[model samples]
Target: MANPSLKACFDRKKFVVAPGIFDMISAKVADGMGFDCLYVTGFGTVASGLGLPDAGIATYTDMISRIGRFAQMSRTPVIADADTGYGGLLNVRHTVMGYEAAGVSGIQLEDQEVPKKCGHTPGRRVIPAEEMVLKIKVAAEARRDPNFLIVARTDARTGLGLEEAIRRGRMYGEAGADIVFIESPESEAEMVAIGKAITDKPLLANNVEGGRTPILSKARLEEIGYGIAIYPAVGFLAAAAALERAYSHLKTAGDSNGLPASESYGFGRICELMGFPEVWDFERRWAQPAAKE
Candidate 1:
């Protein structure tokens, strides 16, 4: 059965914290660790899958394939970052349908142009508010399932200003966006103002590490009236740091003896976590069945 829709989470009024996952292994790990939802981050996807930055370098096919893997491997609902819906109004429709068919519970579209950068990164630019509004409308109309969420994101905070960001967010919500995300609010006061200004729809907060926005706890975010908080780089950054340490230790010590056992997962444990046992069981049951006498 499908996991509960993100709309259910919103209806419950509970703050949903979706950890970002880029690949199959991370998706399985997050599901096993009991995360109710997973975010298919564009930044993590480009970094991990393509060995590139999130500067709109990943193509729509790249994102769809990556997000499809996550949705297939994870038991939790997946919310995908569909950056700028990959193009204009028609492109937004196609992106929405493709993601929904891939089993994504939600799709996030931004207001930036084709070569959109990461929300926290500098040199980001947004299209006109009316242009984004049309995209949002097309995205909302494209989903076959009403429960499939449309998250409209505005990168106008740093470019145009907080007030303009708020205005764009409100416009998006009015255009049928299930959620409005104002990217990179510089201060808590700005967050509060956004929360107050956009009250008609649920809001999503991007909790990017070392990014522009302040990292607030889930409790505090709920207090600030955010319905969803996504930690888009926690897993990727941690994995990168650990790999760096592991490589350095191997170069110096010539072995992994110095690595802490608690922090490391053994080969067999990793296989189990990835359901190798189930694969073997299926093989035994079907591939080489016992004699029926």
Candidate 2:
């Protein structure tokens, strides 16, 4: 089970910091760090898994399969991005079933149209508020587990302005969403406004590095009255930098011996991380060598 259910975390009234984990490597590393929740970032996951941009190119099948694996491997509660619920009302129902059965504790459903763009990126448009409200209603009803969360994300901030985004956030909350995400609030004042307007449910703050929203500390966000803060870009960005440095060093130096990165997390440590000890123990117990004579 997702230890300390995400709903419980919200009910606790303390801030929750969920790191964005894109792949199993990051997943294993993040899950062990003891965060109350983990966010499956669509931008990083789609890029890593499919070598595609997160402009709604990946299908529901693509996202659910990857998210399912992460949720299974993780002992922590996972909140995955389910873009636009993959389609309309019927699709929303199916997505809820798939994500719930796949062990995701929460799903972030955005209000962008089909082929949705990333939240902080430009040229994003939202579906009518009325349309997204119904999607939220269907998603809320489709979830079998009552605690399975429905996070309604409004990308209206970039296009429609802050007031409209906050209005939509309030609407979604009233429509039974467990949390509200107002994407791309450019200023701290806008964030404070969002926090104040949407009071019924927990507010999710997207702390994307270099994104429109300023990166505030957990304490600042809690002070601003946000409930969940997802740092979705940190893992992928860090991984990209590390891989680039290592690859650049290897190509330049022609040897792994004198690399810039410390090699302490080498083969043995990685093997332990990948649970090789259990495999070796299984082999020892089941594959005892037979006597020659």
Candidate 3:
């Protein structure tokens, strides 16, 4: 079973912080940082893992295999991104089963057209309300564990505005989504208004860097009635942007002196993740400690 500590965090009135991680190293870092939960970000997975855009490019197995590592490393529960359920209603059923088998505690599916792009990006499309409702219904029914959360996300705010987005969100909620995420609201007013509109159930707010939505603080989101705020690409964006500058400096000046120096992860840190100490301990029953040369 997934971590119950995560459920406690969810039950609280305060907003939950789900840091997005694309790989095992990031997942370990997030767990070491003591995050309550881990998010397997579609955007981060597409960019960091595959070096591709989140235009519905990744496959179900590809994503699940990646998140399975995170679930193993982090004691925290994982909420995976199942973009548009990888297809229609039947596809949603398969997606749910696969993610659940992968040991994910929750999955967030979007109501977007096939080949769906990132929520923050332009040129996105959505499926009909009825179609998405069916997807949500199938996904909720397919889950083996009743505690496994099914979040129905709507990308209608970009095309149909907040009114239609809220309408679809409610429809999905009725279809048996454990939570609702109306993605990419434009302003603070939209965020607050969406929160107001969906008062019955927990609402999820996206906090993607350089995205369309305003970067409202978690404090503001909780006040607006949002139960969770997912910062899907914060780490990836920060790492990419910072590394680009550092690499540029190194190429141009033959030195990375201007780059901010983070503590070197070095051998010991690497060995810990690889369980080198445990391996050596298993080999040595009563061996003396190594002496300094």
Q: Write the per-residue lDDT of candidate 2 for residues 22-121, one digit (tens) a residue.
A: 9999999999999989999999999999999999999998888899999999999999999999999999999988999999999999999898999888
* Top lDDT prediction, candidate number: 2
> On TM-score, who's better, 2 or 3?
2
Residue pairs in steric clash, candidate 3? Answer: none
Top candidate (TM-score): 2
The alpha-carbon deviation from the true structure for residue 238 of candidate 1, after best TM-score superposition, in angstroms, is 0.4
* Every candidate's CA RMSD: 2.6, 1.4, 3.5
- Error at 60, model 2, angstroms: 0.7
Q: Which ten residues in a row have the lowest lDDT in candidate 2?
A: 256-265
lDDT of 1: 0.87
Task: Give the per-residue lDDT digits (tens) of candidate 1, residues 227-246.
Answer: 99999899999988888888
Poorly placed runs, candidate 2 (over 4 Å): 1-4, 261-264, 290-293
Give the TM-score (vs. native) of candidate 1: 0.95
TM-score of decoy 2: 0.97
Poorly placed runs, candidate 3 (over 4 Å): 245-260, 285-293
